[model samples]
Target: MEKTYLTTDELAKKIKYDCRTIRERLKDSVLIEGVHYFRPFGGRKILYIWEVIEQDMRVSGHGFGIPMANGEVCHG
Candidate 1:
């Protein structure tokens, strides 16, 4: 399957979030590295996998809890 890769700005536009929030808040929190996004060619630039992110977004619940490393929420 072909995955759609999107830049931070592009993802912000599609997800209706400010680019800064995605960078500082979601980048390593809700949006994980290597799963949701990755730096291509070991470069600093990050590309997000749309399919993976979209799927997770659909199932992520709303609550106050810690976000697990594997993208699952740990309600404590």
Candidate 2:
């Protein structure tokens, strides 16, 4: 399958979040490295995998108390 790689700004636009939030907050806290995003060719540019992030976000319930893959929800 062809992978869809999105830049921080593109991901922010798709998810309706600020690029800064994605860069500073979501990068490592929730959207883990390698799984959700990565530095292309080991460079400084970060590219996010839409499928993985979207799946995690959907399962995350957007902080709406929805259950995750591990049967947990965000309480805040």
Candidate 3:
């Protein structure tokens, strides 16, 4: 199956997030390696897998009493 791979800037545009935020904040914490993105040829370029991320975003419930940037998990 051919997957939809996206560049960091392309992902930022599609998701309405700043590229810097993705690289600095979301890359390792929220977005994971292999599943969310990959380094092609094990080189320095990052390519995000859009389908996996989109599906996870729908299920993760990110803003609904979830974990916050300051390392706090909101419990209802």
Q: Write the per-residue lDDT of candidate 1 for residues 12-43, one digit (tens) a residue.
A: 89988789867866788788898999999999
TM-score of each: 0.79, 0.78, 0.79
- Candidate 2, residues 1-76: lDDT per residue as tens digits? 5779999989878888788867766667677898988897899999899988777767866532422455344556
For residue 19, what is the lDDT in candidate 1?
Answer: 90
For model 3, residues 13-73, the per-residue Cα lDDT tens digits are 9888889878877787777898799999999999999988888777866632344568444
Please give the ranking of all candidate structures by lDDT, highest first, separated by commas. 1, 3, 2
Q: Best by lDDT, which number?
A: 1
Candidate 2 global TM-score: 0.78
Q: Which regions of candidate 3 are displaced past 4 Å?
A: 63-76
Backbone clashes counted, model 2: 0
> Candidate 1 — worst ten consecutive residues by lDDT sum?
60-69
Candidate 1 TM-score, C-alpha based: 0.79
Residue 53, model 1, lDDT: 88
Q: Once model 2 is optimally superposed onto the true structure by TM-score, how far is the C-alpha of residue 35 displaced, in angstroms?
A: 0.4
